[model samples]
Target chain A: MSTDTAPAPGAAPPASDERLREVSRVSRLLSRPELGAVVGAVLVWVFFAIVAYDNNFVSWATTAAIFNRAAPLGILAIAVALLMIGGEFDLSIGSIVGFAGMTIMVLSFPSDGGGFGWSLWPAILAALIVALAIGWFNGFLVITTKLPSFIITLATLFIFRGLTIALTRLRTNRTQLGNLDEVEGFALADTLFASQFEIFGARFRVAILWWIGLALVATWVLLRTRQGNWIFGAGGDANAARSVGVPVNKVKIALFMTTAFAGFLVALIQAVQFTGADTLRGFQQEFEAIIAVVVGGTLLTGGYGSAIGALFGALIFAMVQQGIIITGVDGDWFQVFVGTVLVVAVIFNNFVRQKAAQR
Target chain B: MSGNGTPLLEIQNVSKYFGSVIALEDVSAFVRAGEVTCLLGDNGAGKSTLIKVLSGVHKPTKGKYFFDGKEYNFSSPRDALELGIATVYQDLAMIPLMSVWRNFFLGSEPTKGWGPFRSYDSEFAKRTTKEEMAKMGIDIRDPDQTVGTLSGGERQSVAIARAVYFGAKVLILDEPTAALGVKQAGVVLKYILQARNRGIGVIFITHNPHHAYPVADHFVILRRGMVYGDYTKAELPLEQLVQMMAGGADLEVLQHELEQASREGGEEAEALAETAQAIESELDELEEKGND
Candidate 1:
């Protein structure tokens, strides 16, 4: 952007390192996409620590509780961030949770009561397949019609939510199911998805491991793989990616499936823990997951973000939601607090992107 | 490296129609290894349409495409790529948010090890990208810098260097200099020659004859979706190429319009009139030369 660097026309520029200084060290730090999310997570933690000083908010038990609450949302956030970076959306994820949970519950019910009483692992497998199919169909529709994923997935959200209720009611005459722990192989599913383990002198659900594992994998794929490159390319400029011979459609569709897979994981974890799921169990979670992603420093517009940032984004959400209770602040103001954080994060992310572009 | 004067990629009688809109009609051109073929055209002169056809983004509605003397029609961009034809689009097809190394090995990334552990070779990719960039006379201090941070000329050089690295026999650069400053445009033109020197067939497309004249070995002028003129560097001098680019005799009508507008009775208008007269005289000299 400066004149000294602009070599005179017709005079070939010699390959000299001293002639061009691209970015300063300080400016590079300021340009990181996840810087805002990390800073916000710290500030939110500090605020809770001071306000709830007299409460158990600082305890390892409460810490474990925060992890428990954040785990499911974190799983969803990582997947959502990937899809957002790949330049698509999945509004039907919350409904996928309900649908998958219902599939497991209905299939595993006792045979005498008009149920197949299928083994727990088989039911879970079937549910996963259904969820993946939904994801593939969502991606297929979005690609084939060239319509915005928001509209296509919004329509799917309603359609699948209705199916969950109608299909579950037809199976058991009730919109909710429970006592799936009685099925064969239930012990293994519960041990994997719902069991509590003592870590750092506090009991934590196994879902936390899943969340942490997913965050690490998503980070690895985003930073250390070719799929990550294609993801960014497809989101940044689809036509450009296509012209450059990138398989843009395959990347996007796979990302959609990834989001569905995350939703299924959360549903499986929750179902095994509670022994049940209602039709509206995962309702409004789509919005919460997106909020966590945005507050984690991901752009809703796509093509730029970090999965580790989403990890912090989910942490911030859990802290505010759980810490508000310990602080004795009106829990009703939780949304207000989260909403404010979201807007600020977006403004900051935009600023960082501009600063990075300028650098 | 096939510099035996054989066409590596050629298209004949290519016509593309998008539901009655004639984007390109009867456009024919060929490029040979170790030679720069310049396709000169104005906006909407089927330059982009022809590029899309060559790169296999769009199948020509009517025509024949040949690769190394073998008649073929490409159905996808990947097909063109497998045949060693790479196109560096005007926008460069780069993800600005991504790092330079990542953009360099975007679609065809080099990977290592077996399944699950099969990962993109970042150390190799970064080292290769930096080394290739340096070979292009661009000292990229950091291969990790986001491509958006690089100047237009540097970006164009990266695209060219990547093509050369991947062994593209026919490099189709679509308006690589259109978005750069004059200094940067000159820099990119140098890179075009650099690619050509690597025994690669270069198809350089531009609307500016000045940019085209210095680097192009052969010239094909396109106008209104058709081939207006085709000449070798030995046959087409710079002035004659400029004249042919401006649709002969059409320069007179534009000169008349400028003279009519110069009647606004101001010093700036007088300057405009003077410049217009210089252009008219240059056209006149080209006509006299054509007669000789």
Candidate 2:
């Protein structure tokens, strides 16, 4: 009889060079979930640049304008992307913008008509705290009740929106809060939120820098940190994540708070930039942010996405918005363009996902 | 192997009750280091309940659980993991879309920096994942490859290796080879042996007797939430193990009835007699082999 012992541990041969090369080729392409966003961004930019070339769409001023407009949306989109990657959503983010803006306005309006007349910095801080609390409440409700975040945040969206309108009407006797520019410390807040800078003879808002900084930090967190792994795990398969010792609930709660914090930042920027706040300041921003995130290559179902992709998505949005205006096309067509881009991007994302799973 | 020392893990008279329903009643098993304890049972045989009790998913209503010669109670799976007990569920707890290394170090990632600036040590993770998998005799072509691309057997190997690498003193595998084909099941069986060789107390739960008989040092047959029989490999032969797993006395009585019916002499009875005779000869051969 032949004596055949089990193969020794670690006895398998190493992968051949040919196999390595084949694997690397597939992995290299599949590694970047943001590739679709990059291609979409380039295609949109080229299309806009070519279509609106005669209208100075490619000029530095127009480019700066696109960046300026994209900043707040990009900031919110980054947070939305993070939340989505952690397998959650914050539909109340739009309501938070309006609520935070109104908070800053009413507290720092410097008017006798039911206003607190506080300094701008204190008002901003108070608004930020309120936003954080709302986020905490949303997270707690979703976690403790074990309900879908989509439904939970959808309810909060209407609740907060109503609260914003009621508070604005009760305080100002109108749907708007004004006199923000006359508040003490308005200039200080403006210097950080609404300040303008000239680069290559083009003016750009300070919000652009904040957007870039936030994106860089988010990208780092997504790719380089333990928390990033938890986010991916929680989104990909929460039960599995918990089985492996990931604090899935904690990661999700933090993501919700982060999204609210992002909403507060956008509200502060807009309040300072416009010198006032309207009850409808952030109308539909939640949907828009989700759209941008989806366009950036984050899955609607969660667990796969990139912050850099969201940034590009925001840029594409801003380009289409401003490009249409510059090209003298009907502004209503902007929504049509967004709808088309979303569908096309989703199809492209599916194609890329299938390719990545090809093995 | 078991009597040489105290078992690495021992569950004594464990009983679990789900409200009014009795899921498991007075089950007992012990796993020794460097031995494979095969828990054999078919579906609805309280195998899952026993596994849950061992893995700390449920606190036994009555019974003492001892580990490393000390009695303790586990409040959660996390607590069990902290105490060096890792359970690889049938699902494997792996994210399919994630890379093999990422799945390998899902929750317990290695970090490389200080305080707030800390980052995932990707290099260490990839290298360790490769080395650990190789220890289980799996040569992964790329650590960056997603876990979904691996075959079912390879995925099970990855989970097993991950448990061992993470310092599991006792490894509980839940139907790991249930979905695999013959070749794949053999591959997983080999890995179980590998784990056992490393002195890990392996509690392998499966309904397949063929898979268990070859690798098991001790077999504990579970039937309807109670222990039917427990025997060491030397004391109990493979044929008896199969018979016990298939319900020993009941199956024999059924065979005798079939033989009696065949003696009545009809076409159907003749066919039944042929089948009964075939089964008897197979058992005879198995008994002869056992006697040898």
Candidate 3:
């Protein structure tokens, strides 16, 4: 891939082309798919500004709502993006989320028809254990079987989904869990999640802050840490990375586990914040997370992506979800819009990637 | 150093088998520090199997392996690496997208401080990688540059320098110049010599006699999983080494077949003669192709 070299012994080496050197920097910037996405984002915002005339279109409330709704999805997207960049996938995340949330609900088991005897720490710890176990299971199976994660996790998705349905039915013969009267459950949801802080006169939930923290942490890991390098190397070229002693299998398994943990954390938050669990909770949410990650310029085939990109991708999705309502368009059209964005982002990302490779 | 240097690594009575198929049988070779031990063989001549054993990708089914005068049996590639036995495979275990410094310090990345707080010392990594490569006569100004952007020869040099920097007692280069252009091949051959001069035991595996004849202090030839011959630099004759690898008997038969076809001349006979002439040229090449 390197061009700098002396001509082989007998041949006349060609002179360095200054023009090629000058263009290299430009090419390097364009290689980051985020650049094109940024451009696309700007274009979309301008289009909205011009076309969307409703008061909600430019309102502070609308903006906060968009960020708020996108926060959990953003966190999930960042996790998936990291795994995708590492060349693996976790279809079990949605189930892990359901299970983790259910575990939290179960831990806060109301003793007297209202209050859980346990504190938040114990509940959180229990949730973490369940999440990590699910994650570890995903990693273990994927690594051991050496099968496509898609198939492995797909099977897990069904297993978890079926388990969720069965347990919910057996416990209450109903779809949702609710006993909002408990003080412990109430405090857990309100203080840790439902609680809000004011910024620029717009109320933002702690969940959004958590989402931002996740993105920042993910960004740091992907860029600054050795683990991040291994993820890229593993996905880019597993054999090459293994030969270099990158522990390619371990890195991939860890990624799967991380994705599952993120899913579980999100589910736990949802359960605590909402004060209940729904049997149908987290259904098809994996596709939404994948959509957000893809929109953020993360390659579906893995090897290159960013947590920041995925966050912005989630932002884009949330914006459109809110924007469509502000425009008074049918809510069902939202899927069409997401579908369009997904295809366009994928195509645009491929182009940017190809250009980057050529450079 | 002794007159010809002491053996840094020695393999005795090594035999490898995959099911009923014998890959290497009763093969013995020794690599001495400050010298190149060239392992030459034609395709399907057990070179790959021998390397797998040497590099710890495989443990010889039956053998006594010695390194630094100590017995060894490596369970994994990492174990081999920890023993200061480094192998730069033909493709070179390099991550193309990673920066030169990162690839240089791939497995053994340097860290500052200690314990849970220890982090990679990027500055030291970049500085030392550049400095060391420069010392190797490789002028890589920016260690931040991705290895994917380097030429084949330069990649090989980096791989070599990395192995040495990591304190490899013995460097086994698997056909470093096999895929390179003539000039690129020459550049790599020069590095093999450099590694030797640094008092590193070098086991250069190649079928090319031309590349090996000049640098090798000892030569080991393998055929059908068995050693055809072993010769020290003083005893090794380049032509004979080439002839052995080419399957001397097969080459003679090919030449005889060619002469009989050429002597029976006609339009059809001429075509047969031309085919025979081609076979003769191939046999003729066996004489110097190894050296070339």
* TM-score versus the correct structure, for each prediction: 0.89, 0.90, 0.87
Best of the candidates, lDDT = 2
- The sequence of per-residue lDDT tens digits that candidate 3 reaches over residues A241-353 is 78778898888878887888788778866776687777667888888899888888987777778888888888888888878878888898999988998899889888887
lDDT of 1 by residue, B1-292 (tens): 3244778788999999999899989988998877889999998898998888988889999999998999987878888887889899878557787789888888777776667866777777777777778777777877888888888888888888988877788999999989976667777877777777677889999999978887777899999999999988879888788777887699668857877876755698777557645544554453333224
Look at candidate 3 and give me any clashing residue pairs. Answer: A1-B149, A2-B149, A2-B150, B209-B290, B210-B290, B210-B291
TM-score of chain A of 1: 0.92
The order by descending DockQ is 2, 1, 3
Q: Give the TM-score of candidate 3.
A: 0.87
The runs of at least 3 residues in candidate 1 whose Cα sits more than 4 Å from the true structure, single-residue gaps closed, are A1-16, A19-30, A112-114, A355-359, B1-4, B17-23, B256-292
Model 2 misplaced stretches (Cα beyond 4 Å): A1-18, A22-27, B1-3, B249-292
Q: What ranking of all candidate models by lDDT puts the best one first? A: 2, 1, 3
lDDT of 3 at A23: 53
Report, for every candidate in turn, its global Cα lDDT versus the true structure.
Answer: 0.84, 0.87, 0.78
Q: Give the poorly placed runs of model 3, Cα more than 4 Å off.
A: A1-28, A111-120, A180-185, B113-117, B252-292
**Colliding residue pairs in candidate 1:** none
Each model's DockQ score = 0.31, 0.34, 0.20
In model 1 chain A, the worst 10-residue window by lDDT is A1-10
